[model samples]
Target: MRMIQRRIRERGEREIPARLIGELVMEALRDLDPVAYVRFASVYRRFEDVDAFSVEIARMKEAEVPGGGDDPNRGD
Candidate 1:
């Protein structure tokens, strides 16, 4: 939470973009907890169909491949 606050402060903007906040949350969860990240992302992005979930799962799988996923800290 403090990290996010610091980021907002550093931006020096009165209004923070929703995308920035989503990225921050995603980055934090993706490193610390992938499952939670995915879950949160689904809700944050408001996935109302199975297709959306599939796409996200595919992305995760792609990341699982060698040198694919951006974050090396992700667990199997």
Candidate 2:
């Protein structure tokens, strides 16, 4: 939770909205564990159907590859 706390501190605000906390959690989870990220996102985003889950999975898969646009250190 330190990372999330640091994110809030970095924002330099006394109060942060729930959305921002969720965003921080999503980002940290995505980088730390994709599977866990998807699980959390499914609940956090409140996916109504399987199509939404499929789309998120596809997006995460794309991000896993080099130069898929989520990384800046590719080919280094």
Off by over 4 Å in 2: 69-76
Candidate topping TM-score: 2
- What TM-score would every model get versus the actual structure? 0.69, 0.82
- For model 2, residues 1-76, the per-residue Cα lDDT tens digits are 7999987999998889999899999999999999999999999999999999999988887787776756655452
Q: C-alpha displacement of 57 in model 2, angstroms?
A: 0.6
Q: What lDDT score is found at residue 38 in candidate 1?
A: 82
Clashes of 2: 0
Per-prediction tally of clashes: 1, 0
Give one digit per residue, the lDDT tens place, for model 1 in 1-76.
7887898899999999989998998878877887898899899999999899888887877876787765567664
